[model samples]
Target: MSERVVNPTGRGFLLLDSHPAGCFATVARMRAEAGGDAAGPGKGPVALVVGSSAGYGLAATIVGLARHGIRGVGIGFERPAGRRTATAGWYRTIATASMVAEAGGDFTFVNGDAFAEATKAEVLDLIAERFGGVDHLVYSVAAPRRTDPATGVTHQSVIKPLGAAHRTRSMEFDADGTAALREVIAEPASEAEAEATVRVMGGDDWALWIGALAERGLVNDGFRTVALSYIGSALTAAIYRDGSIGAAKAHLEATAAGLTDRLAPWSGQAFTSVNGVAVTQASTAIPGLALYVGLLRAVLGDRMQSPVEQSVQLWEQLTGARPLDLDEQGRIRLDRWELDPAVQAAVTERWEAVTSATIGEHADVEWFRTQFRSLYGFDVPDVDYTEPVETDLPWPT
Candidate 1:
């Protein structure tokens, strides 16, 4: 078959084929950061990672397999390959599973809505039949909407500020010509909207997953679970730190605390991990985050780390000999690097001076665009995009 083509447009780039090289690059990074294979392990520990198909979850899964030689069961919601479009997460999952199998690790990919009780039941059955139990449960789920199992109420997350509308510079790539910066205003979210955001993005589902697992006797003793969260600088506070999503994060953090207590009998621990901001599918959808990420990247420069790198750091801290370090809020601080005073100062300086006219010169627009495209399996230097690709690739069985 010929290599898949990439059609770039203003909205985003669509991949025509599965870029194996790009996927392999992700694996290579995982290996490098892990510092070679871990010693003395029988297929390592087993892990169940929700949202393991992409973003932080994908990187974490890769690290588990490549670095620690863990057997992995991944649950993700992804669009199947259609006549006209192929989902990047589907391909990434396939590529990741293939690599793990080749490296002599067991991997299973389940594509479905993680919030559904049926999906949770499926996970429990799989673990019973295969790995018996999981040592780690990583929750990195990001969704625009979530349906409550009890109330049957579906809540949609909004990216608006909480109190007042905030205006900021936004960047967009023009498929026709040059990149453009425009003034984007994010309106305040209503009380109901804020509640809905928390309902969708909050940790209710996460808590439910743990409860179900524990009740089913699937959680092993000393098992640990982690949910990813974020706390950026003050610059984006209105729409981020103190915004609707922030309310959700607060709920998530609180959930972690409550779950920790619930799991105390089994010596299990639950933690909310504060991660650094990166170019992710979820981040791009946030109203004014793209501009901030671009500026943050420019300001951080070499200090900025990718999800793969951050995953390794997290793994080391969790699995290493030393006890995990947490902030006063009882959360892992993976975002400490990003929240450094020097970095924030620089970002603030740039944020204040940035305008439509100066955005091009001040922001790392190209880097942001490249990272965004990379998530979709495009713009990898080693990948041959000119060749025709097989769109109907099989999922890892």
Candidate 2:
């Protein structure tokens, strides 16, 4: 192993490297902020979290261990190969595991493709030997493509509208590191592409996991499962809420009832949790979301909630520590703050008035940039980037 200074690489929203110290610091900070005070060694609930390496999934794992004291198993697809560093999610999950162990809690991690049947079997066997049964299941997988285990077919998800072309104002970074707004026109997806997106992003895998758990008798009464989703404002409807992603989300949401019905035998339940807007690896890739998030932050200021905050609330609802807040379709709505009419109105005003020249005035571009950098384990507070650090840190025990 060699030591070297690692700076943030990649342009725009995509990142190429992850910093170990920065990722550890982020997990520590989030755990502290999201109710780590309650963490202790005890017999808490058991949770199996799919996609538990980053974003809301990472937050859920942190909250479960640090706040709710849950014995947890996390599944993620990440690489920590020869020369290059592991993905940010890998570091984050390792950090979480380290923190949980320090707190005298149980947290295991499996790094592999969550959609694969062998992965499912390994997870199930581990659960059987370690936790006996899982009390909660958190599904938050986000990927560009998923290979069907049965059919051996890979379906790639695309971010385009279903029926009509859409034009939206988005942001791009300049060579000098200045961000500028640009017009992005997205053409409608073909029928095959739309279906493929659904196949990749929808609830099929979630349902499969549940079925596997049930087949192994790994669910008991009062068991709960949650899948994370987002429903943005009308400002991004064409590219988000009404786009092919939205179709996949709709399928995910609709799958909840079926999952609940399937779990009825054990008095278990499943629901989609509509989470708040936050900077995550997935959000950075969506068209227009960066700009919309910046404006939303500028308008809402401290009222906006991060993924950890929303996840803490989700844990409260799931564990019956707080009353469930469901929408008309019986799904949890943790995005109430983002969807507040006043907040949306203010964001809309900023979205209409803002331009490249006035972006700094109307949008929290700095905040957006900071959050985005934090996702890849950069720009974190008190990190010593000047020092030569090991890129390939061992996964925490």
Candidate 3:
């Protein structure tokens, strides 16, 4: 009798680990192609990553070290771990920071808020005193709740569509890809709501952090910066593009434009990566996304690019390759892959077949859901979930 074991990394580890590496590689290439020697930039960079605990930002930190071959400092302010639940990204950071140090690179983690002036000051002081100044800054913050530093009012962003409530069927893969009836989702947000969403997501925090650092003499000329964003697909348009999140991204794109202008004198530019969708801790919560993931999986091939792969692709764009193909809004448009004629043809075809007139458990959807469930450290075939999961994640200092 033999027992099967599913490794933890098998779930979503690759997306987390390789994502930043791919982006950094692209950044390095961009630096090289710009006819600018990549390494002359201020003894490399003391890299500062906002939202550095998980998702795209953490990947950026890891990628900065692994792919870019640049070494300096890393800083962020993620809340320390709490009772019972451990953030997956934090663990990955530990492992990644250890890898960076072993290779003789500097990595530092300061958990808190990117928007907080105090936190920003702390990051700058750390960089100025110990590592000189940061040569690059990566803004990847994605918080849903923000208290206006001035107003003191707490705000929460919703994951709803931007237009009138629309009825759509998405998958609840946790129970197999049953075409669960997604009720007509909420309507488009008001201008005030949209602006608030943007305030939390837009480039204000990023610009502020960069400005503070530069003012403190931590920025050298030719520094580069980037932020993460998404445009999803037509299927997710209401919930994503026109939705509250979409509104925020719109503001984010504008934020980049402003940052680009502000940093022009330093020969620095801020670019936004219209990153593709993936099974991330963040992406899962977006309304109508589970179905998008399932269909996207069937469409992108069994090789649906993991977040790490997507990040690599992102890196390629960031570092002087081709600015990612942009939309009318002048924002990166990687989400176009979701709506490509060929890719859409495939997902729609499978969706129709699986969710046809005959309604029962879809074996294909079931398999996908199982894999997805495994992503959250549940329902894996290889490892016993009952066994306490042990890891050796090295928290970056």
Candidate 4:
């Protein structure tokens, strides 16, 4: 699509493409969300974001800068620059960074790994040099490959159920909007894989960043730390749980405890939010998750489905507002709203109605496709997707 309609609600973000045109369109979208005005946060915040290119990461960054006028420093690696599907979220980030700078908030990007001790040190050094110290830290890194500094070996994670067979219906992006029938994939994971997955997605990396901040004295008073987490419906339990990633998240929840407790004396608090899912490159690859999330979006009301709105809602409700709604276990429940009793009941009812023998006749296929295409900045109504995208993605650059 030529012009992407950014979500005005401001809860999170809905990404267009990584194209230069796409970037311009996204800034337009964000501005529109901000009521055709540039965003600022009083004096603004010194913000640091990992995975700040697309999905929730980008949304959080944009909200931090565009809505609050905070200057941000982004740290993460790019996906070798070309190839759209199995790629990097950097294009969106680059465009957004440029947009933020033009809007008057500084946005410096660093291409680096978050899992490495060296990388954390480097980010700390930069923060000390540039913004003094970050008032807010957003850690949203999602990596599949992590290297063991001690062993010099690389580990790759898989998205299969742990032990039993998991049945799930998925959106076949290739098929446009139709739900593709397939048996849920199940594979065994080793202890090493499980541990590695925890190391990569869990809270160790987050803790490392915090520790680094503390060491550099860059963590300001009452600094806040947020990391994203998820707990889909029971249907996703197997692939998510026994799966390589879920185990990591379990550790992540616990990691928040450790970090929060550790940061307590300094008046810093750690909170994790379960965010609403809009289509993203990373979410698209998940087996049944695409269709599930797509249908979930179609069924959810207007405001909740809008990523930008969602991010704003998140900031308003969870971040910097009142104390976040942490469970007795000290975990926040952002996504729980999406999975609330009424919401889940509706989604379940809707899923059944749309998954029958002749489901197409009853379902809204148009909406389904729109959601999928919107993930890549295609099929957006306001944008003219034709005439070749002129936007730069830093591929050849």
Candidate 5:
């Protein structure tokens, strides 16, 4: 059996044997969130999910299939397993497919670049063949680069602040397996870089997907489409809420407004849901958000929610179990719990005093490390990591 080692930088692969336990743990959490007994045939709506392999996208897909009994079609970009190690998203996709099948839910997954028009066309074709039409579409894609099909120009998303360079503290693992605080200085994004970031991370592709699906007559009446966004606290606003990514998010919100008007003819509705901060691959890439998340965990503890829990809440609200509360700008407020007055007050107090010397005392750094490893199917209690396991698992064709 081969043992996996986590990269100290927290952005690389870990060698592992199998991931059955992590996969099951994800399903168990989803079932629990839905109040148990998520077993049933696909008798509800048919939903299409983009970037449906990790984080919130994966959680939403699980909820749509297990809780809502939707016939699920997932689209993702993941590399195949190689000799030394497999990408985490690839393993996650395999696990998601297995769990969906176990629940007797119809699941189809397409592994490819979701930004391309070809991939969109293929997904529409699959939906037409299998389910005839879709009632819900979830857009949760997070990529660094996108290519324009029309002009063959590629755009890359930037992670820098808008103005001057920003400095923040982030967590990193040491060679001897200890959490250490590191300083991360992110440079300001150039005008071109900011523009490219918007082009890639904005809602252009999302709008295209809806348009293509509608053109093919694959959108049901009263259909709904949702795109996820984030609005963090003032502490990280410079690098996150008001930065290049934030500009892209603004564009996404604008696109939602446009899509709502565009889809009015079909009686469809579009929404932008501002979800809470959670441990995701995409979130980890942000400059200083991890420190804030660690502090948030320390403050909120058990009160804090996972992506699966948040997704369940979103499903309930959208399905009319709860009232849909929108902000002045017509955006859903799923970040309410994260940004609770009490929670933010505590976090703000700690943020003011937190430093390299005090981070360990003031933040849940261990919890942050555990959650990050869990995303890659490591540090799971149920699985015996020493046992030999197959790396190559069959995915849906």
Candidate 6:
């Protein structure tokens, strides 16, 4: 394969291309850190992770293979247009499949819209033919829109607040690595808009997946399910915790209870994991979150947890290797350290005093940039970006 210099396209939270070598390196690093805790070959649980292309989904998949030797089925929506580069998630998947093969674990990737009924059916068929049943299902889908299969209605989620227009401090990063801080105002969502957000982002699809799996008798006894979520502190609460997306998250967490009852027949359980903050594609798109994460990393220092680290802990709880840390609402609180009182206090102090001119003094801008770029395989360590690399790598079957 001829080498090509793959620079990241788009700017300020928008990425259009990915580096294959860098994406592979990123997965390899995460797998190594997760450690080979697998008891033996074929000893791990059989898992299906929706949205397993990037962010928490990708991390969970890698951790499952490296830490638990899970035979995994990953569902994601990514594109690899001919001549142009594929999405970062596609490269990540290829790398992950290689890891699974090396570790002697089974893996299958479904590349399509997870919201569609056809996609659900395909996953069910795969489980029945290959794995017999699923032991754990991780719902980590993060999409801006979803079209209901039955109604043929498309719902687009918004990031606006609920009651009133919310204003917050936000930052924008250019492709050249320069960033600027500015104030952003997000308006209140209309009734229809709020409903649409819930439809796209809430637990509806998650519930649907479980319902289908249960109906197909694809759930093993002691089956477990978890949907990823985030509950930020007061720093970006107005734009995040109280925003339209937050409403959907609340619905997601509430669905866990009903789902537990559905899985009760198999003695199965369902939970919502409130994950810690890290630079992800979704997080970078939210207003003020980029800055908040930057400040959080600066204040927390080594206390900060990467998505992979959180996934490692999450599996420990799911597999009974560690105690589940639940909140009053019975949801796993992986974001506890991020929401710690001391950490919040420190972050708040920096948030208030940080200005456009002084952002570098209070925030870990370099770290934030690195994390964000690494999501698209641009700034990953040990990857020689100066060398030309193939962009037309085939997806692992």
Output the better candidate (2/3) by lDDT: 2
Clashes of each: 5, 0, 26, 24, 1, 3
Top-down TM-score ranking: 2, 6, 1, 5, 4, 3
Candidate 2 lDDT over 180-270, as tens digits, reads: 9989999999999999989999999999999999999999688999999999899988888899999999999999999999999999999
The global C-alpha lDDT for each of the candidates, from Candidate 1 onward, is: 0.80, 0.89, 0.60, 0.64, 0.81, 0.89
Worst 10 residues of 2 by lDDT: 35-44
Better of 2 and 4 by TM-score: 2
Q: Estimate each model's TM-score.
A: 0.94, 0.98, 0.78, 0.84, 0.93, 0.97
Better of 3 and 5 by TM-score: 5
lDDT of 6 by residue, 1-397 (tens): 6357888877578777788888889988888878767865678789999989899999898888888888858998998846668888988899988877776778899998999999999989999998999999999988899998779999999999999998898977755677779889899999999999999999999999999999999999999999999989888888787889999999999999999998999999999999998889998889999999899989988779989889999999999988999989999989888988989999999999999889999999999888888888988888888899888877788
Candidate 1, residues 104-192, lDDT tens digits: the string is 67778999999998898998899888887778889998898998999998899899898898987667766653567767888899999
RMSD of each: 2.2, 1.1, 6.9, 5.4, 2.6, 1.3
Which parts of model 4 have CA positions greater than 4 angstroms off?
1-18, 34-42, 80-88, 173-179, 317-319, 361-364, 390-397
Tens digit of per-residue lDDT, candidate 4, span 1-397: 2333222111112332333444456645754674424355236767788877667777777766666676758875766433232133555656676676567667677777877778777777888887788777887877788776657767776676665556677645222224454445555666776777776778876887788788778887777788887777764567774577888878887887788788876788887877666666566666766556655665664635455665666565434655566667776666665777887777677677665454444334466666554554555456654546533245321
lDDT of 1 at 96: 82
Put down candidate 3 lDDT per residue, 1-397, tens digits, no spaces.
1122323343222222222222223333322332322333234446667776566665565555555555655554433333322345554455556555565656677766666767767777787787776667777877787766767776666666655666666554222234443434566676677777777877667777877876777777777777888876777778888788888887777788788787887888777878777666677666667666766675565656545555555555655555656666666555565667888777666555655333233324454555554343444334344433433223556
TM-score of 3: 0.78
* Model 2 steric clash total: 0
